[model samples]
Target: MIKLCLQRSLRPAVLLSRSALDPAVTVRKVPIVPHIHSCQMGTRGRNEPREPLNSPKSAKDFIYSLHPKERTCLLMELQSFESIAIAQETLQPTPPTRAQIKYVLFHNSIPFVGFGFLDNAIMIAAGTQIEMSIGITFGISTMAAAALGNLVSDLAGLGLAGYVEALASRLGMQGPDLTPKQADMWQTRVSSHMGKAIGVTIGCILGMFPLFFLSDDDEEEKKKRKAALTAPNA
Candidate 1:
């Protein structure tokens, strides 16, 4: 039997039969492995290029991609430049035209002259009394006081000129011709000047009354002293 078994095992069909007939031999199902094609391995077969992560589509998008500190710095720089430009635009001076200068002078001249005369007159009257009281020369004190009063009047005229120009602009009176709308504006301007001139003139003239009385008393005293000194020996 050993010889026969050995001979059978030497043949392939007898070995298969022997393995099939054995109770301990078992068979297992083989797993199937799918083949991957070259095209599916990567993006080698794609038609479009990939976009970069850092690439932006618009200004707003570019700003969003920056770090928080960098974005804040850039915004601050932009605001600073904007503020500088605005300041430069606002600070630039515009020269006034000749027509505007002429208009100002024409409208303000009468009041300025009237105020100057009244002011000088009052100052001169006051200065005469001061000189009499202090026993100083009338010419020097009167001239100095008149100069100071004229300076004051000139400053006042300058201020009033600016005010009148602003008022005219507010009233919307531009051209030389007066429309119905400008009628009220003209009346207001004229009335203001007239009233100011009248008030200043009357006030200054009245203010000189006390000085006049003092000067009269000083003159009378001087005359009496002179008469007493020049009288013949008695």
Candidate 2:
């Protein structure tokens, strides 16, 4: 049985060897596949050229790849950004301009046409021989008026000079202008005189009224002295 099996296996092997040895047999050429490696298409490390990713598509992926520090910093900066500065709404103070100051001074200096209740009250209060309150108030008012008037007059003088220059130009008559020194001297003179005159005038006027009057006690004291002098030796 073993010999029969060996013969059966060797019969096919002998036939294949005879076929391989045959010179008359024609063999068709199989096409040679090119050695194309998939790995060769992929680039390596940091220097590798990357294709641009589509926007809004791989944005999450790009963000996810960022370092934790960079991600936190970006988020913090975004959170701290303010869209607009909150405005502090406030009322702006309107400072007094030169013209306004002048107008105010001039208005106060000019006598009112009608009897002003306030002015009359002021005058009556000032003229009274009573409390010292009126005197102090009048003094302050006088000083303030004088100071403001001095400033206004100086401004008015300048305005007059301007008007004169305008008129002179119209008349085609040019003249030497006042020097800055002369103008300063004039202003100083006016201010000093106004302040001193106002102060002195008010002082003198207030001084006219005696603050104290002799009471009954003083009169009695005088009478007693006179009676003692006239009395005969006691």
Candidate 3:
């Protein structure tokens, strides 16, 4: 009689045979098919084509070709110094500071003050009540005009910022993986100049407010005194 036992997992099978005359059992080992894991087969099937050294797809790929420790150190160095390198390469002018904005406002106000006084003198000399009202209306209208100017300037600034941010992203100065502090720094640089320009414009508009009341009141006073004197005589 013969009996066979198979084992799981690439192990050898055992065969048992008995001879009727000798009453002794003989055992033999037989080889079985090797076991293969499904995961290993899938991994082999999913192998991607390697990028060539001569034509690397990206900086990351070029870095990845280095030894593990060397790659890690190089990446760390790049992360630390990337911003400095980009800033050195930049050709754009620096954004205006708050102090510079104040200076600009002061300079702009000088001209605006001269113009406001001239306008008031002209309206008052015209001597029509309607001309005085027109001067006041013009002063008030400047506030609205300043607001519109600020809006347009802000929109233009935002458009320019967006274009710069896109370029920075491409150049690796700004990227999707940037930390919070980095993003804030980038936003500050982009917005500070526009804010300064808007502030100066508003300052000039506010400086014009006193012009609205600059017309001479002496004429009205003289007219009132003349009316009183003539009333008693009449």
Query: How does each model score on lDDT?
Result: 0.43, 0.35, 0.38
- Model 3 pairs in collision: none
Per-residue alpha-carbon lDDT of candidate 2 for residues 1-234, written as tens digits (9 for 90 to 100): 221223432343334434455656444433333332211111112112233444543444444555555444433322222101001113333344444433433332221211122222333334332212322334335445444434443444333433332332454322212222322344434543454445445434553333244256644654565456556645
Residue lDDT tens for model 3, 33-82: 33321111112122234454443244345544455454444433333334
Candidate 2 Cα errors over 4 Å, as ranges: 1-184, 205-210, 232-234
Worst-scoring 10-residue span by lDDT in model 1: 36-45
Tens digits of lDDT, candidate 1, 105-207: 3444433344444455555555554544433323345466556545554555444444433443454433333222232354435644664565456546554
**lDDT-superior candidate, 1 or 2:** 1
Candidate 3 deviant stretches above 4 angstroms: 1-93, 128-234
Q: Between 2 and 3, whose TM-score is larger?
A: 3
Clashing pairs in 2: none
- Candidate maximizing TM-score: 1
Model 1 residue runs over 4 Å out of place are 1-125, 133-184, 220-234
Cα deviation of 124, candidate 2, in Å: 23
Tell me how many clashing residue pairs each candidate has.
Answer: 0, 0, 0
Candidates' TM-scores?
0.26, 0.19, 0.21
lDDT of 1: 0.43
